[model samples]
Target: MRLVTYRATVEAEARLGVLVDGTVVDVARIGARAGVPLPSRMLDFIRLGPVAVTELGHLIEEAKGRWPVDGALPLPSVILLAPIPRPEKNVFGIGLNYIDHVAESSRALDTSPELPKQPVIFSKPPTTVIAPGDPIVHRADITQQLDWEVELGAIIGTRAQRVSREEALAYVFGYTTLIDMSARDCRRAGQWIYSKGQDSYCPMGPCIVTADEIPDPQTLDLWLTVNGVEKQRNNTSHMLFKVDELIADISQGITLDPGDIIATGTPEGVGAGRDPQEFLSPGDVIEAEVVGIGKLRHPIVAG
Candidate 1:
């Protein structure tokens, strides 16, 4: 099931939806009309766990390919927000999880070429998130090296700590496409919070495909493009530390609660990794995708 958080208008409250036949079936409306209970927000819905997912699935199946189910709206008639537009906590991130990306960073950014012995973890503040079609702010005053990294974002459905790699996938609620917008030159003393955590730096979602629909997260193909030209492309198979390993490692002690997102590191082809280097400027456009999940397109706008 492809679940989303959307709004009929800019001023309307965001509501949970199920995307089917190119139309958004309002989950809460369907539940209310069907005499069932369902939450209107993505985060609250996620906290309900499998039971909520099961109920929503039944609602969709019962629709029988119906268009405009009561309260439903055409996809283009609504605004699609990030699956979790305002997360409860900072987004967890992994850096250089792709071997090829590690090599490219070494060439273009003069970073180490050797692969990390463990997952390189980082965080992006909640303010960094924006919905699909939003502008990715280019903070020229702060730094000129604005860049893009397309990543796979995993949304956690349940609390997990000290989870084994084998059981890590069980904790995932679903997946979405996340663009890791970065200010390449903002790195200071080896920290990335400022470089990658600025407002509008994390453009996520078209929708989240439920975990049951994608049993193997590592088999998806992901890529990023700028102004219609491809800059990055790689299968999740090339990930040095796969999703399960990341979940297990990151959850070793820190608790991963419902609605928390982990952005699995991007593969090579970022602007900073290009020959002679490249960067985004106002008016430029970026489209990042994790096939099977969805794609996110954001225009580069001045900060």
Candidate 2:
């Protein structure tokens, strides 16, 4: 089931719902009536584990009876927000997973960085997250080389530590689309924290697709386009470290709790790797898509 979080009205707070047949079934309301106690927020659902998700699925099915009703629950599109807005922890990201991205970035740096003797990990602060259709803040003064990266974000379902690659995928809740907006200059300063941690830099989600929906994570096609021009186009099959390996590697020493997001890295065609370089400016539109998951589209605005 595809789950979403949205605001039904300007005055109403954002609430979790299930996306079905182009309508959102409010899970909280349905759960209350059905005598199932489920959290109204997506993060809470993640924290509740697979049992809660199963209950939510049942609630969604029951809630389907109420949709298209006149003046009852408001139409879903009236005020939609980010599905998993404000995650508890920084969005974990891996660099140079795609062979093309590795090659291009290496060439741009005039040095071939070793293909991660280990998973080169970094964090994008939670504040940087925005939802699909939200505005991406382009800090023109601080960064003249703003770039876009289309990445596959994996959402953790269960808490795990020191998991093996064979069992890594079992801990996943589902998948979503993420745009890892970057400031190239800030990144080149040596530390990636500040460069990656700008408000509205991480735009993710339309909805989270349960792991069962996607049979093969590695075979999916992922792409990104800027202002109607295809800038990044590649399949997940090119990833140097696959999803299972990434999860196992990341969880080796640190515990991966529920709702923790790990972006599996991006493919090629980033602006920073271009000839003479291309960068994002106000009014630029970015759309990132992954098969089986969904698309994330946002416009660039002055910070």
Candidate 3:
């Protein structure tokens, strides 16, 4: 199921819906008219447990029984927000999780590219999140070296702590595309938070696909383009740390809840890893695409 959080009115609360046949049908709204009980918010709906998911599945199936868009709103007629526009906590991030990226960056900086013995971790504040069509702010005052890293974002459904790698995938709610917009120079100064956590730095969503739809999370294809030219392209199969390992390691003592987005790092082909760095500037458009998930686009603009 391609689930989303959207709002048609400026004063409306975010509502959960299923995007099907080019229309995002209000699950609860339609279900209510059909006399089915469905939660209106994605987080709240997820909190209802598996029964809720089953109900959501049933709702979509029922809606499709006749026609998916029969009573649904045309997707283009509404504003699509990030699946979770505002996360419950900071967005968890893994740095240097791809071997190819590590190699390229190390060589670019003239350092040995040794594989990390542990997952390199970081977090992005909630403010950094922007929806698919939103603008990615490029603040000129402190940065001229903004870059892009297309990553696979894993959304947690089951709360977990001390989860085993074998069972880590069971805790995932779904997947989405994550573009870790970064400040190359500030990050080079060793301040990851400032470099990666600025307002509208993280662009996520299109929709949160239910976990069942993605059989193997690490087997998806990841690619991103700047102004119609592909800049980064790779398969998730090359990730040094698989999704299960990442979750197990991070959840050793930390509890992951529904709507928690964990960016599983990115692959090689970033702007900073070139002889002459290529940073994003005003009017530049970037698109992050993940197979099985969808595309997330952001237009770079001056702040």
Please give the ranking of all candidate structures by lDDT, highest first, separated by commas. Answer: 1, 3, 2
Candidate 2 ranges beyond 4 A from true positions: 66-76, 110-113
TM-score of 2: 0.94
Q: What is the C-alpha RMSD of each candidate to the true structure, in Å?
A: 1.2, 2.0, 1.9
- What are the clash counts of all predictions, listed in order? 0, 0, 0
In candidate 2, clashing pairs total 0
Q: Mind giving the per-residue lDDT tens digits that candidate 3 earns over 136-180? A: 998899898899999999988889889999999999888988999
Better of 1 and 3 by lDDT: 1
Question: How accurate locally is residue 207 in candidate 1, as Cα lDDT from 0 to 100?
Answer: 93
Backbone collision tally, model 1: 0
Q: For each candidate, what is the lDDT?
A: 0.91, 0.83, 0.86
lDDT of 1: 0.91
